[model samples]
Target chain A: MMLNLFHLTVLSFISSLKEETLPVAEFVNKSVKWITEKFSWFFDPIKNDFGDKLEDFADMLAEIPPSIVIVLVVLIAFFITGKKFGLATFSLVGLLFIYNQQLWEELMLTFTLVLVASLISVIVGIPVGILMSKSNLAENIIKPILDFMQTMPAFVYLIPAVAFFGIGMVPGVFASFIFATPPVVRFTNLGIRQVSKELVEASDAFGTTGSQKLFKVELPMAKTTIMAGVNQTVMLSLSMVVIASMIGAPGLGREVLSALQRANAGTGFVAGLGIVILAIIIDRITQNLNKESA
Target chain B: MPVIKVNNLSKIFGKKTKEAQKLLDEGLKKEEILEKTGCTVGVNRASFEVEEGEVFVIMGLSGSGKSTLVRLLNRLIEPTEGDVEIDNENLAKMNKDDLRKVRREKMSMVFQKFALFPFKTVLENTEFGLEVQGINKEERSKKAKEALELVGLGSFIEQYPSQLSGGMQQRVGLARALANDPEVLLMDEAFSALDPLIRKDMQDELLDLQEKMQKTIIFITHDLDEALRIGDRIALMKDGSIVQIGSPEEILINPANDYVEKFVEDVDRSKVLTAENIMKRPETVDIDKHGPRVALERIREQGLSSIYVVDRSRNLKGYVTADDVSDAKKQEKKDLKEILRTDMPTVEKDTSIQEIFDIIHDASVPVAVVEDGKLRGIIVRGAVIAALANGNEVNGDDA
Candidate 1:
């Protein structure tokens, strides 16, 4: 009897709101299609320009022989981090391990994707974050928008990204950018806001202009925090590669996706290990950059 | 002439400043004005003038608007109402570019926290003011080096501010201000963060610098002892308004109201009151005119056992005791010089009362207040005791 009553309530609720009558999904689809049709000229140029540059960069990374790439990364690790031999050796061994798996080209492509996505996120995110820090109006408006971008499921954004940029590396880059951008923006704003009040007052007392204070005092003091933001962006972008490969992006992510389809556990495990190695190398390098600046 | 003149200056910090200003003009108290307009009155109608070469101090407890008042002098914190004139030019009327120029050239500030840029070396910090003025690199560095030498920080120029002690960092802060060779220096509690010994040393260093440079200084501090020690003149503030403005002696002797009296109640009077403050005109015998008989008569008339003998120019030759005058009279001496006691206690007019205690303790007569051999006044033992016991009473009626 109790089960019958529950079923009756569910039936009544279901009858009141039909999916076709709601029309929310359809409205969103139609608006997206109309906007694309009307504004393709505006978006197409930007998309083409970014797509060409990104592809060229990826090709450049691929053109380098695996041995030369490993040595170059090892040298960079040593020089940029104040001659830390441990870090340099670790980077060399890590790259060699990835190379041994015969996944070198796939790792390079994944590296390029993460690099481009992180770069775009930083370039767009920093100034917006600065703007947010400087004005209360910008902070109030951007804060909720950043919250939505960060909290909404990463998969949900891929749909709109595909509608706008189509299914290719560009859409994958676009999707990864959307997923990775919030941290850099949030940390930039937080970093600038955390600058000591006394330091700001001192700069003003010395007659510094608004721009001079921002560059000379605020940015230098906020270097570590902003670098932390960049590190987070890199990691987030790396995490999104597999999810992004569902839309035709190529990389270790594509290998993992193929392995999943074939139900091949060994292939999937090796690709996953490669991704982990890449993440650790990049993370250590960025953290060392942060420490050196500090 | 005044180097800086602040006229009817007021600063209300909050969004409702306009309404707060109206309430202020309507004669509302700070609390009442805040309640009516939801604004904090940082400074309220403060008016004062800082003379050239004078150490003008603005002193108050925390949240009394003394810090705000100094910032307003250089327009670091804009005033809601009023005008500050540096030389003859009105600061309130100047545009942003002109204000910056003034800050760069005419005024420099030393912060309470020794606001040296943490990333900058001592030399770089010292060069900040000159760099802001667009001076050439070579010239600015030379000037910065000179300024650092002036503050005794030349050896530490290569070190970062974090590497220096609090006193050393504050010296770098001072050097930074001096590097501009500004006409006015605004120091906001420049030594309050230092240890007591270091604070005293810094005060003496500032005095030494003042003696050589003679630059006009406007210093802010919450400590009364610091103010008394350094200020040529002090303005005391309470609840965002200046309650009194006077020399340290004037403030101590005649506090304006109950608030000021309470503020100064714990002060050690002997350190503040000088011989000039407690001295009086002395009974004297002239060396050029008065003979032994006249000297003895004058001493007896004044009911004293001795009298100071001065030459025709009032040059304090010495003091003559009554017994010595009588002996001179019995011997029919023509020269009063022989009767003169040149070893009698003598002190400068500016000597503090504390120094006078030892001088008067063993003296047979009043101590002569002398300056460059001229007799200024005389300090008696009784006067010092009376002044100490009734310290606040001296200037009680003046307020």
Candidate 2:
């Protein structure tokens, strides 16, 4: 926001001369293009190998019989929600409804996408969170970057993501990753810091090494909060599906995007309904998982 | 020998510690040091030794640095100056690994808030210290279970800390520290969070554990009664510096300063007072050396209701009431031991005044303070009441 205001002042002064504007957009575009060119080595494997593996995982899930998948999901939901079966019933009916609508393939793809993005977010975010908690300088440096990642339009990440990975699920995963990561990082940091000072002292008093302390005390204590963040990340990734569809990412999001272009409200609503079913099932399951851990 | 020794330790909680420490050494007070150098002295030139198998309690009011001082012993809060030697190894000079070795094998702390890991079961919490030392799973679990049972929580091993009461949780905390079998146990207000009745029980339990384990313990508390009840020696602190370090009786009887005086002024002395303090040097006649007539004359001369009769070695045979002795004398009895009655209540010298009060109230004769069957002194009802009333032992020793 501060950058925007600075650019705005500069733009206003520059605009007094006719059809001229600040070169901030050009600068960002050139910088990203330069990064893409210079760091092709870094971006290529992620685009190719990781993207293909994700696709295969999604395909493998899609190939499973709908009845079997529904039963398994329902069983997990039943047990995880403490066996009363409210969420289990929801999962049973919701999966059946999506199957009945012939949107099973799209649902699997969206589930894979959300799960993969959230997994990536966790793997990267937790350590970053730990670093931020451990050092004041790291916290100060990363907090503003997190603010930018969270507040910037999700659509803006697509350009560079597509530039690096081309149009596919990979860039979609990339955009969802950037958008969904902050909460995990933030909540992880909050969770660790929120551990009572006495608890920290108690662990230290026992002479636990840094890693031992983190895993045995801090991480386990922070699990619930981190799970809360992960749950948010999953839901946020689901929210990004439609936006992700604009970059040729497959799933129910594609259905939603195509339905929008063709002005097919009935199909769009059905696809939107598919996304909602997946979201509610995933959300309840993750939340119940968190409760179980707690 | 001292198990742990802290020499001229200071912890200044700011960037300008060198200047603050210098100011502190120059005898500037905590506030003055803070004002001059923008550094708060958390512990100021504190030094004390904890003897092996001793319960050394550091007592102070809130913000008086007792807590800070305890942490400094374990290097939990780094001292800005000086050294803490645990078994001749300097804690401040050690690397991370060596310091950890000291912490894991030499000492462990029990936190005031009962800082059991909420996610861990009681067994896991207790297992923590041993687990950190890379003990085998079987051994660590066995030790942890034993430690839990030592604190009387054997059945609750599978239960999480939240499921336990505050007292039980503190037990788990104590068990955790004990599981490591460290020579020194640092308890930072370990029982201050419990209800009064439970606190008393825990204090008794700790005393029991201390007796059994014989671990050198550094206990921190703001409560003087708790300190007096548990501490073998007490260090009285004021504003980040120790004012006095002495036994509970010494601190109570002769406070080092007005602060120490004020701190202990409101204490209920009945708790610290023992039979030894109030016991009078009773008049007694040796049965082997004196007859019933001598016992009767002595009782009459002392204007006493009774006189205790003893053997030649002063082993209490029993007390003889004046009437009985006179009756014996009238009968021309030669042995005072024949008329002596053994029904008078006998108590140990270390027995607290409260216990003595109950024992002496129903007894007709003075309560005999006996040690190994030998009479040490006698606690009469008058002397017991005088000690309670004056909050100090009277001139009972004068006799």
Candidate 3:
């Protein structure tokens, strides 16, 4: 009887202040709307011009002969992976299969997106990671921001990203940039921090300046770890491709999205297969690079 | 002036150092301070000075702050209190730029872990100090190669640090430090990671190098034997406080307290007992004036199997057994030199009993303690054994 009374009291308490009374959803909607309205001036040039440039870059990559691209990538695979013909053959066959499926142009565009996104992550994430490793204040502040970037459902970033950059590959990149950057930053911080303390002392004992120590001792020692981070960034960016297509980004992801819309299992399966092949090839190449450097 | 002077250097690892410092100044013990403020007293107001060209050793057990104390000299671990002065300039108070200048131009350190850059080849790792100093590539490479050659790693320069053994890796670390050609070399337990035999070899190599270059070296080691072997003076630390500081002989013969007495008690006396301390006055027949008959008579009277034969100037010639001298006298061989065994081993006065143990162990005759080509004293097998069994009692036998 007492438990039932307590339950009824709690239920009445929640019912007393319910629904839009919280104003959380309405508040978020207004904030996003306000940001979009105010930032249209800033977002316009980036959306129009940067969007055109990214598409042109993707188109330029697509224009390359599939066979030539295949041979070049296979050659890179062969050389970097200790000349393993097995890996070289796998890349050769994987690219040929994607080409055979008529997803060559889409694959090229996806490649461009992942490539640029990963490049941006490395360029921005490494210095931030280095900063985090060097300073506890930076680590304390940036760490939570990174956690927010990583753990919040990747879909949530799309709302802000679109508000700032608008629809297409530009926002796709912005979304991927948010989602994929944490691993690189986190890994970079961890890598640099993991450098042997004695080595650090040896460097300092010789009186190395900040940049000298970073470039000469810390970075070189942390290379494998940082590279591992970069690899993770690239993989995460690849994972973001299909989700990015919801924003009208052009890639194999768009083909998969269209296939889903038409309810054509065959077409969707083929496009998904193309993505899987691409993911495998990229993953192997990055992993091989890691082993070779180490 | 001393090359490196450290004054009341203290390092307290804690957030509440102000309170810990207050407690420290109030003369609270390290444990008391830790209980009060939760701070680890890494080095507690340790003070010492290292003279130019002297091997000033800082030695203690692990966590005794020997490592912390050494790091303070180069300002690797900033001091919580007091100051370290290199030459006349205060290292603890200097700005970052000036402190860096002192580090780059005045001092270099070799680590216990042989912290060479793994990605770099031996040549690259060795030149790292000079490289960071902004020396030109050509100049730095040349110096690095020479340093590697000095450490006997010239052939291994093209290889990576991972390719070398522990001993050779430390040689690269030594080379890296030497490449900068700094005036002061700080070695923090540099050979503590090596095999015992290799550690001994490295110690000897360092001694040889120090003698030639005379760089003021601050060597840190937990091994008392190592400190005794290489140190011109030793500072013994306990609970981050320097309990005593003195020459090795002084430290060994007159340890400041029971802590030191117990520490030195475990050191192998053979390594510390030199031939000079154990040698007795030799009973010899002068080959310049005495015949083999006189040598035999002296050997018989002394109730000894063998006797050393020295010249009128007391220059060591050789030794003669009583059987040989008697045989020579009976054969009408007049000269003691004719019966003398010149193959008997001779050791220098400063040669440790450890070095003479093997020769004395199987010897048919007593070993001559020769110095400057003159017969200084004699060392028999029993004397070496006696020195090993009893620490400093052999010094009394010099009479």
Model 1 Cα displacement at B27 (Å)?
4.6
List, residue by residue over B1-399, the lDDT tens digit for candidate 3: 887778878899999998998888888988998898899999988888889999999999998999998888888988999988888889999999999999999999999999888999999998888888889999999999999999998899889888899999999999999988899999999999999999999999999999889999999999999999999999999989999999987787678998998899988887787888788999988988999878878888889999988888899998888888888988999887666779988899889878999878877888898988899888878778877886645653543
Candidate 2 per-residue lDDT, tens place, A188-220, comes to: 999999988998898899999999999999999
Pull out the clashing pairs in model 1. none
Comparing only chain B with the true structure, the TM-scores of all models are 0.92, 0.88, 0.77
Q: What is the lDDT of candidate 3?
A: 0.89
Q: Write the per-residue lDDT of candidate 1 for residues B1-399, one digit (tens) a residue.
A: 998999999999999998898888888888897788889999999999989999999999999999999989888788999999999899977999888888888998998899888888899889987777678999999999999999998898899999999999999999999999999999999999999999999999999999999999999998899899999999999989999999999998889999998888877888888988888887787888889999989888878988899988899998888898899899999889886778888899889999998899998888898999899888878888877887776531221
TM-score result, candidate 3: 0.85
User: Model 1: per-residue lDDT, tens digit, A1-294?
Assistant: 999999999998898767448778899999989977898986686568877777787888888888899999999899888887987898888889888888988898899899989999999999998999999999999999989988889889888787777776788898888889999999999999999987888777778888888988899888889999999999999999999999878899999999999999999999998898899889988888898888
Clashing pairs in 3: none
What residue runs in model 1 are displaced by over 4 Å at the alpha carbon?
A1-23, A46-49, B22-27, B326-338, B394-399
Pairs in steric clash, model 2: none
lDDT of 3 by residue, A78-143 (tens): 998887798889889988999988889999899989998999999999999999999999999999
> What is the TM-score of candidate 2?
0.87
DockQ, cand. 1: 0.61
| TM-scores for every candidate against the unseen true structure | 0.93, 0.87, 0.85
| lDDT by candidate, in order shown | 0.89, 0.90, 0.89
Task: State the lDDT of candidate 2 residue by residue for B1-399, as single tens digits.
Answer: 898889998888999999888888888888787788899878888889989999999999999989998988888888888899988989978898999999899998998899988888999889999888889999999999999889999999999888989999999999999999999999999999999999999999998988888999999999999999999999999889999999998887678878988888788877887887778887999979999888878888989999988898889998888888888888988987677788879998789988888888789888999999999999878887777776533555752
